[model samples]
Target: MYRIGEFSKICRVPVSALRYYSDLGLLPPESIDPESGYRYYSAGQLPRLNRILALKDLGLSLEEISAILDEDLPAGELRGMLRLKRAEIGQRVSEEQARLARVENRLRMIESEDRMPDQEIVLKELEDVPVVSIREVLSNPQDVGMLIADGYSALMPAGIMPIGACFSIYHDPEFDPTALDVEIAYPVAETVTDVPDTPGGRSFERRVVRGGRAAVTIHQGPYDMIDQVYTRIGKWISDHELQIAGEPQEAYLTAPDDPGGPVTEIRFPVA
Candidate 1:
């Protein structure tokens, strides 16, 4: 049996700190010397102390750490707690990564703005994609991509080739700029998923977007410029008082520009 002093020395923890921990019933020593009133600890307790230290390093209080150890928690509950912690950490990490990415992109934006090209652009009356769609608010990223792909897959087995390309029509920045309230759709045979014979499983009024129809030029390039076209089209709309009807839709004339360059014809429908 090692005295408190020797035990604290071996554990590289202060004697006073170990006594406090013992008083809190966090890591009680193996025994106490009755005659000297000294606390005695075993070398075997080192691992437990190490675990406490590690948990403390992870921002857990001694009380929390002790509860975790003493609770005799089921494997599933413990796994769930750990999974929640991991998800929290992952979000923090993603936020940091996004911030870094945005900073880098801002640098590029600055450089690009300095070399701004006067790429002549225009707007035209765009065609609508006929399909069945489900409007869902996207909060979970795991479901966002799957939402569109699953919608397409669900539509494809019905013998309907999407007339327009599959793109999300965001009403607002619901989640974040990176994530938003989006409408994912593909042109089908006015199909319905649940409501049989309903076009695209949902019904929206067939209305032409009223706006300042500018000289819309189509770009056979990349998706990145798709947003840029919106920006340009928006400016034209504002300058020309051509109000927009709905979220501008892009009718993909052909396959997207492979290896990343420009879109084929990003049509901005205007009034």
Candidate 2:
């Protein structure tokens, strides 16, 4: 028999942790000192403590670890749980790698910030998106914001989802920013038009958020001054031996509506 302090030294675990494990019924001692209320663990419990530490390192919850130790789950279920854990770890690893790559690219840009020319657009085959839309006219730029919020609110209750960027199609150039007819949509199944009298009308089509194939320029500024962003993109395209093919789409990475952080990002579809 080993006293709690001696057991802790052998296990390299804190005394408080052993007490906690005991309280949680995870690793109870064989006996206790009644007069002093000190814990005394058997030499046999050392292996059990090692297993608990190993399980903890694998990110298993206490309950799961207890269940596993108790042999409550079958082998198949255990394998499935381990597989899910592996997939989750793989996803996190990929995300970290991508984040590191972005940071390195940004560092390079910062080093050459002064000599860095206007942004260049890359062409990519835009994926097909299925969207249900509501045809409404925006009274002003502010109304665009409200309409989007209202659409999200209305669709959330109905379970419609937005995929990438929530935006509008300018029906006419004369379409007033003060009074513009815009369609707010989210990519769902192409056939999910009818919702037994949904808030928005039915009849969705396969429309690729086109013109993304054109060269794009990123802008970091307020939404009101976004027109200057367009001008910069236009100049960049002209200078880079590219031509305009489709109308510009402003994909909001961040918006000026929020109090903190700079609003940025607009994509110009060009030939």
Candidate 3:
């Protein structure tokens, strides 16, 4: 048996922490002096103390730790919780890194405001892909994200996972910010059939995105500023004496909720 201070030294935990744990009934001492009330812990309590410290380090709240300890949570359950916390931390770190990159890009854009930075445009022959899609005429452009999310939700019930990136095809002959004729699509396996319908009464139909030569440019930043990249791509197409042949498409490379902003690849079919 060791006194509170001695046990603190042995466990490498502060005396105050030990006392607090004791008060919370999380790691009470094995014995206490009848007259002076001096707390004494035994080596046997080391395992319990270690568990409490471990859970706390994993970002478990004190109340949650107490419940877990008192309930004697199964080792497998505890391990599952740890795994979830690990994944959450990893996602947070990735988001922060992306945000830092966005900040740096923003600074560069601000510095080069006087001149148009060289935007790389690539001409590639795209292949036809079968997709499940939802077409809608949205009055407000902001609802486009929501529409895409709804399309995904509709697919979940049908056990359909997107095989490739989510993309939207602009069907309107000209750009209309107020009214968009957009088709939100997810590429799926050719064998997929019986697609689901969205809650908004739009059916998710299987369609082949026709293969063609296209001028593609990757735009990184907010969607509101995407028009600038489109302008640049248009200029590049004209400079190369190419004619726009079909509807435009934008594929989301990064998730819509990504911290760095949505990274979109814009494709304009050309001849």
- Give the winner by TM-score: 3
Candidate 2 wrong stretches, greater than 4 Å = 114-166, 169-248, 251-271
Q: Which pairs of residues collide in candidate 2? A: 121-216, 139-178, 243-271
- Tens digits of per-residue lDDT for model 3 on 140-258? 88898999889988898889999999999999998887889999989999999988678777898899999799999898877798889988888877866679999999999997668
Answer with 1 or 3, whichever has the higher lDDT: 3
Q: Per-candidate TM vs. native?
A: 0.39, 0.50, 0.56
**How many residue pairs collide in each prediction?**
22, 3, 0
lDDT of 3: 0.88
Q: Each candidate's lDDT (Cα)?
A: 0.62, 0.66, 0.88
Writing each residue's lDDT as its tens digit, candidate 1 over 1-271 gives 8888999889899999999999999988899778987888999999999999997877566877887888976888767767877787789998798568656654675697975335545555444445555566667644645666666555556555665566545566222654556666565455433322233354332222333443465665644555676676567556544565555444444443355543544344445
Ranked by lDDT from best down, the candidates are 3, 2, 1
